[model samples]
Target: MQHIGIAKLGKRTKSLVKRLKAGDIAIIDHVDLDRVTAESLIDAGVEVVINASSFISGRYPNIGPLLMASEGIYLIDAVEEDVFNQIKEGDEIVVRGDKIFHKGKVLASGKTLTVPIIKEKMEEAKKNIGAELEKFATNTLYYMQKEKDLLLEGMKVPESSVNFNGRHTLIVVRGHHYKADLKILRSYIKEVRPILIGVDGGADALLQEGYKPDIIVGDMDSVSDEALNSGAELIVHAYKDGSAPGLERLKKMNLPSKLFNALGTSEDIAMILAYEKGADLIVAVGTHANLVEFLDKGRAGMASTFLVRLKIGEKLVDAKGVSKLYQSRAKISHLIILVFAAFTTTITIIMSSTTIRGILRLIILKIRLYWGF
Candidate 1:
């Protein structure tokens, strides 16, 4: 099969997806592409994907390729990295089976990842998951030993202009099911008026959901300029040494921000910040929790996540699968049944009440006399 589209290239799938338009061929260098990136690509409506690296390198059953295949998106995997240097953005490229062509010149060739191929790889990856888990656990232990101070006594929490003391603080991360989970919490957000905190690209997610985040925290790499300029207080997640790469972007944009210098992921820092500020309850949406999720994010282990959660304890409510926990709203069929029951109850009351029956009968008698029936 032959497919043609304009090429848009980026080494990072997250950054590339922002520029992707419907029917545009996405050229990415993602390896063992994670589910979230696949979802982003699909959302961009790209007709075809050309990956410079393996779609699945037997890396613990990553489902990005499987999802793309299932969605019928053409995937050309493991192409040469030089394709980035060879093809310019907006160059019309043709994918003839497993090969990419630019201007009728064969640019690069790769394997076409089909469902069967991805499934087989996934099974193999699952078989090696035990080994992956062993390595992950080892890293976790090693880091925990060194970073035990995080749990023993947290870092100096920065004072925020936005108050979290004794109020619900919603921390959003751009993880799995983040969009659906946010949609489910619309009413809670409207009612409780929680302090909304967005971690990096999560700030964009909040904006897409029509929420103006009260505070934006993260490395500031993945977030959009619009979200940064939304008047939300910004906090740059910095290294323990106080090196904040994200701060430069804020400076260039002339957006003022505070720095939270600590270890761990941005989401972890956000939670710790809220807890340190004496938040009564912290609600987390789309934050990574499981081993697979941590692995997908390329973290050697979830050591920091484990320690952060241990520190936060019960105040942290994970809303990752809350959408599956209960129906967010009553079904239309259920609403119909409720309306029918209410109508039936009113009719039954009118028929069963003697005073109501007498009144109805008198009204009917008066109408008949007036018409001389």
Candidate 2:
């Protein structure tokens, strides 16, 4: 690209997304960019991404750069560690083949990511992925051996005010395409009124959609203070020995919460909790469902998730990216019916109104008198 506009800077892509407008250049200090971050940048309508860290370190095929490049965004890879420090926010900048400039001076240089390069890197990543998968298997076996109770007998959770018995429970995680998925299930959420459970940052996601979470489950690191106090019942997911760091934060905020010691990720616990509460169905949005996604979340072992599926696969449904399934609008037939109803209501109003009928007759009589008919 010949020229670019103001630079929006943030170390975390998620934090930066709220400020990004269409065509804004994003400068982030992220390494091995995950697909979710790339999707967020794309959704924010950013045209250029300047990374202060490696986009792909050949570490298990991090799909961020590939997704960005494919989406027609210019991605400059790893200019320098000091790129973030050197570039000030709101500075108008120019890009020329991996070089970033301001005031006719080159600020930093790096490699411009291309489709071919991404394919090559992905090939290299495939080789690395094998070893990573092996290690993940080992970790899963180790954790499964230690935490067999979570799957075998089920987890004994603390008493909760929100009941999930015989109800459909929706668990949201601030993961890939969470916003879109939640939007797609809007009708289901409204009609069924599923028990809403927000996992960490997912609580913020629910709040963004104007829905209050019935329960908030997670480590409580990324959720906002407002969400924590939105009257959602809080459950702190602690380690097996019952040490909860997030619990301390809740206490400091004077918020009441229960403790749940589990082995899997918070999202996993959310599912398990709904399952044990006798939920008829569990609909998950933005939760990791595949190996690539689990890797995207930087988790080595999915033992807890594996066991969770084994325990409740019949009742569980993953609705990741469900927004792509349909258009975000009423159907043409539906719109036509709505228009017809409005037209029929107007006609009925006109027919029933004496003033309007008299006005219409008078106007017609006047027209006839004027025409001499």
Task: Give the alpha-carbon lDDT of every model.
Answer: 0.91, 0.88
* Candidate 2: C-alpha RMSD after superposition: 4.2
lDDT of 2 by residue, 128-216 (tens): 88788888889888878776776798578778888788999999998888998998899999999999999998998999999999999
Q: Which residue pairs clash within candidate 1? A: none
Supply candidate 1's per-residue lDDT for 53: 90
Candidate 2 colliding pairs, count: 0
Error of 1 at 62 (Å): 0.4
TM-score of each: 0.91, 0.78
Evaluated with lDDT, which candidate comes out highest?
1
lDDT of 2 at 239: 91
RMSD (CA, Å), each prediction:
3.5, 4.2
Candidate 1 lDDT by residue in tens digits, 1-373: 9999999999978889999999999999988899999999999999999999998888699988889889999998889799898899989989999988888899899999889988998998999899999999999999887777779975897778887879999999999999989999999999999999999999999999999999999999899999999999999998988799999999999999999888789999999989999999999999999988888999997778899999989999999988888775778999999999999999999999999999999999999999999
